[model samples]
Target: MNPDATTTGADAIDEAIASGNDFDGSPIPQAKLGLYHQVMGLEAGRQRSGVSNTMRSRIVRIGAKHIPQAELNQMLVDADFAPLKDKEIAFYYSGK
Candidate 1:
C-alpha cells in the first residue's frame, strides 16, 4: 500500500476490530495486541497525521500472520477503553 495514503490510527484500529483483518483484508493475529497497541498509540499521538506508511505496513504484515477474529474483538474493546481510562485518570489528577 502507498505510504502516502491517508490511514489514521482510528481507521486502523476500527478496521482491525470491525473486519478482523488489516486494510488489505489479511488476517491479523489475536496475540499481537502489543503491535496493535503500538500502532494505535502512534495514531493517538499523531491525532491528525495518521499512521505512517512504515507502521501501517508493519501492522498489515503482523496482523495478517497472527491475529484471530475473537481475540481481535476483545483487543478492540481493550484498545477502545485504554485511552478513555487514561483520560479519566488524567482528569482525576488534574482536579486534585
Candidate 2:
C-alpha cells in the first residue's frame, strides 16, 4: 500500500467519521456520530508518555478490526513493536 496515501486507512475512516458522512457520501446519523465523537474525544485527550505507546495503541485499536490476531502480531513484530500482551489478545481477538 502507498504509505502516503493518507496516513493509514484508519485515518481515512476517522476523517469520514469526523465529516459526518460515509465514504459513499451519505450522511451519518447525528446520534451515532455524536456518540463516536464522544468516545473518541476521550481517547484524544488521554495522556501518553511516549510516541511508541501511542502508535501501538492506535495500531491495536484500528488493526484489530481488520487484521487477524496472528497476522497483526507478526506485523507488529516486523515493525519492531512489542507483541500483543495477553490482555490485548483477549480483548481484541476474543470475539472474532
Candidate 3:
C-alpha cells in the first residue's frame, strides 16, 4: 500500500480518517516508536499505582512528551487520576 500515492477508487482510502483519528492526540516520536510497548506498560502502572515515577523510571515521559501527540489528540486520554482499589470497577472519560 502506497500511503503517499493517490488512487481513484472508493476503497482506495479508508474513510476512518473522517471519523477523526482517536489516537491523533499522541504520536510516537520516530526515536521513541520502539518504546511504544514500554510506554503502554508505564501507563498501566500509573493507572494502577496512581503515582507516576516516570522521572525515576526514565523509561517514559510523564506528560504529553510521554504520550504521542496523535494519540493524545484522539481517542487517547491522558490523566493522572487514581482508581480506588476498593472499587471493583472504575471508569475514566476524556473528550474534546
Candidate 1, residue 56: the lDDT equals 41
- For candidate 1, give the lDDT: 0.50
* Top candidate (TM-score): 2
Counting only residues 3 or more apart in sequence or on different chains, how many pairs clash (N, Cα, C under 3 Å) in candidate 2? 0
Question: Which residue runs of candidate 3 sit more than 4 Å off their true CA positions?
Answer: 1-31, 48-96
Candidate order by decreasing lDDT: 2, 1, 3
How close is every model to the real structure, measured as TM-score? 0.23, 0.58, 0.18
TM-score of 2: 0.58
- C-alpha lDDT of residue 58 in model 2: 88
The pairs that clash in candidate 1 are: 27-64, 28-63, 28-67, 29-66, 29-67, 30-67, 30-68
CA RMSD for every model? 16.8, 5.6, 15.1
lDDT of 2 by residue, 1-96 (tens): 223335345478777776677766778999998888899889899887899998999899889988999999999999999998999999999998
Candidate 1 structure quality by residue, lDDT tens digits, 47-87: 45334544444443354345653453355456542222344
Residues 1-78, model 3: lDDT tens digits = 334434444444333222222233333355554465568678767644323443322222232444443453342223
What is the C-alpha local distance difference test score of each model? Answer: 0.50, 0.84, 0.36
lDDT of 2: 0.84
Candidate 3 versus truth, CA RMSD in Å, comes to 15.1
